[model samples]
Target: MANSPHGGILKDLYIRDEPLKATLQAEAETLPHVVLTERQLCDLELILNGGFSPLQGFHTQAEYTSVVTTSRLPSGALWTIPIYLDINRAHLDTLGAVPGSRLTLRDPRDDQPLAIITISDIYTVDRTQEALQVYGTTDEAHPAVHYLRHNTRDTLVGGDVQAVNAPQHYDYVAIRRSPNEVRQLFKKLNWTRVVAFQTRNPMHRAHRELTVRAARMRHANVLIQPVVGLTKPGDIDHFTRVRVYQAIMPKYPNGMAQLSLLPLAMRMGGPREAVWHAIIRKNFGATHFIVGRDHAGPGSNSQGVDFYGPYEAQDLVLKYRDELDIEVVPFQMLTYLPDTDEYQPINEVAEGVKTLNISGTELRRRLKTGAPIPEWFSYPEVVRILREANPPRDHQGFTVFLTGLHASGKESIARALQVALNQEGGRSVSLLLGETIRQELSSELGYTKRERDINVARIGFVAAELTRSGAACIAAPIAPYNEARQQVRKQVARAGGFYLVHVATPLEACIKNDRAGVYARAIAGDIKGFTGIDDVYEAPSNADLVADVTKTSISQIVHEIILLLERDGYIGDR
Candidate 1:
């Protein structure tokens, strides 16, 4: 039989009463609302669907503290991760939130109310403490830690959430099963001994081999549950991964495996996350879960050390095996033996026999360069799917973001680069000048820091879309703040390459070359909050290339940018 949920009871919090749901929805429309972030939305979906069983709502301060410090809920249940409804202080005050008050949680993509929470506690948290206790690091290099420090808000409001409606998901509707639905399907299939395989990456030949081997070893059927929600920052997007999963489904022996999608916002917390994954799988009706080396591990710290030991996840899952009520199937790195045409665990391989393997980095490199991938490494259909999703770099899209002081020849350089790319003629090139974007996109915005950030973000959105559609986009906006530039970089990076070029022309040189005389007016106090005058211009320290217009002509600078792109394989040799 399938193991029981983590707390022996599944907490499906969705309100089934039609009249009550309508009443709550109507009341929520009048209440102060918090727009949920992507991670929060994912968490809310699972919570309402009983995937995160035993919890009916976001944790109160005490529960959060208990989970953080002791890796357990207040009731001593093994809940390693904290679920919070984080809000900024300004928003908290705006809502006038207090105990016994109600607040609506709306989707950011659209203003649809998904749930209403009765505020039970309103408190602030020490983010650094939470980061250390939950993610084991305060270093911002870790993705989850970075999110904790920067992206997440300071204050957390805890309450019992009443779901008016489940979060809407239009994709993969057939495979996106709730806990109850999955349990029913397992029962229908008579799958009592089911082993779950958790993955956040595209499955390959070796992955199939290991999963099949694991199921056989456990004497159980297989549940290929891949995460479709937020994973590591640079991981392949879920759409492509899902397509790959679909293509690989027929390869599994008939009736031996099933596929399900988990809308989980992974912390990449390694050992603790592995235990958490096992519990979630158990709630989904799995009798066992496979924990591999460095399970859910974020790559490396800034100091170039792994956040957790390779076997740490396996060890932790084993430690909690009895309490978790699920078997922990441990597997090591698997490599292919060409002579035997089979895969074996690294430790099980003989000393003299030849073994082959491909790292994720190597696989990406091969994909980007359109290099030949050996059939032994991946199935042809899988490789074909990945190749289609990730075309050769020359055919892929990219962005060149130019940021510097006003009148620093950024516009001229950008125009010249656009012409150069047009002449090369592989892809369409777009030039987004600061003044043009200001007049067209942000006509009502001024030169304040926040407005400038919004303007730059608008430019980034356009550039990112263009890049995603396989175009070369050159944006020359005087993005003065490092934070805004970094945000643009991240936005563009999701599609393809992002190159930041710093036109490091000095203040005196910019003033000397000023054609608009705006800089002089700002110096004369005719303009308030002018960048580089009353306002500060935070130059980018992480630029891919730095050009000084005083030292080089615009044409030469454009040539240098082209060379940089060519060197990075964003463009091919002309």
Candidate 2:
């Protein structure tokens, strides 16, 4: 039989009765609706399914403090991550939210009612304390820390949640198992000794070999469980990773392995996260778990230093092995031995053997250029899926964002490029010029810093959407701030490509070319915040494409851009 659930019993919080569910759904409409964030939705799914056993809802202040400081619940049960519900201060008055009031949590994607929570405690969030104690960092360089610092609300509302329904999933329904379902499946398969492998990335041959080795050492079946929920910022989307996982499943020894999807929103918390994962897998009926080097690590800091020591996660998981109730199978790094045409654990390899390995960065570079991924490293089928999802840079959708002072010929250049791309078109072309965007997409936005940031963010959202549909978007906005532009780049790059073009035409040249009298008006104080005069324009120090309109003709600049696109495989050579 599978191991007992964490805290000794599985807690199913969902209201499974059809009549009760209908009543709850109807009651939800009358209550104040709280739209759940992506992370909150992930937490709700786990809570309702008993994966997060012993926790019936988001943590109260005392529980959160205990978990953050002690890595345990108030009852002293091992629980490394603190799950909380945050709400904007503005919403408190709007909804009359207060202690003793019940509110409905709705899915942001479709506004579907998922759960109801009766507020027990509403208090200010100690984000700095949470960041330092939990993440071991006050630095914003950490992704989760960054999110905690900015995205989260000022106040946290703690309550007991009553589940109405699970957050709906349209894909991978068969393998997206709840904890109880997985435990039953283990029983059906007679898999008493199962070792779960946790990953947020796509698996390759080395990973396959490593997991198989881990299972063999423990005399267990393998559970290829990959997280389908939110991961680190730049990781591949769950859809593509799921496809890769599906392709890799057949490569596993028949009847010795099974595939399941874990809806875990990983915090990349290194050691604590490793322990957390082991407990979760144990609850899912696994007898053992594979905790490799740097397990759940969040790479490096801004100083190019690793955030956690190598083997840190392994050591921490091993420290709590008995209490965790799941056996820990530690793994060393693996490399491909070219001579043997096989993968071997790096530590076990002989002193003088030829070995090859590809870094994740190198693999991404190869994929971008359509470089061959050898079979020894990864199966061709997996490679094919990755390539299909990420196509060659030339064929993929992209946005060329032009940022500079007003009257710097950005609009002209954007129009010219749009026309040029249209003439050589394979994908749809779009032009989002300054005046046009202000009129159509951001009319109510103003020139203040916050409004400008919002405006640029809106553009980024639109560009990402367009890029996902494989369009070539040309945007010419006087986006003065570097941080806003960087945010846009990060946002759009996840969907397709984003090229930042710095139109480095000087202020004098812009003044001379002011056909719209914008510069003259600013000089006369008629324009309150005209860029290059009253307002500041922080030039990009690291743009993908930089051109000076004064030095190069429009045709030559357009040709240069085309050449760049061709060289990068974003377009065909003409």
Indicate which candidate wins on TM-score.
1
Clashes of each: 0, 2
* Model 1 ranges with Cα > 4 A deviation: 1-11, 402-413, 445-455, 477-487, 500-555
Q: How close to the true structure is residue 185 of candidate 2, measured as C-alpha lDDT?
A: 86
lDDT of 2 by residue, 492-566 (tens): 988887889899999999999988787898899998987789888999998987889889998888888888778
lDDT of 1 by residue, 1-574 (tens): 3453232457688888889888998998999999999999999988889888778899999999999999899998999999999999887888898899999999888779999999999998898898898889998889999998789887898978989888878999999999888888888988878889989999998889989998898788898999999999889999999999999989999999999999999999999899899889888888889999899999899999998999999998899999898888999999899899999999999899999889999999999899999989988999999999989989989999999889999999999899899989889999899999999999999987899999999999999999999999999988989998898899999888899999999999999999889988999999998888888889888889999999999999999999998998888842
TM-score of 2: 0.87
Assess the local accuracy of residue 484 in candidate 1 as a C-alpha lDDT between 0 and 100: 86
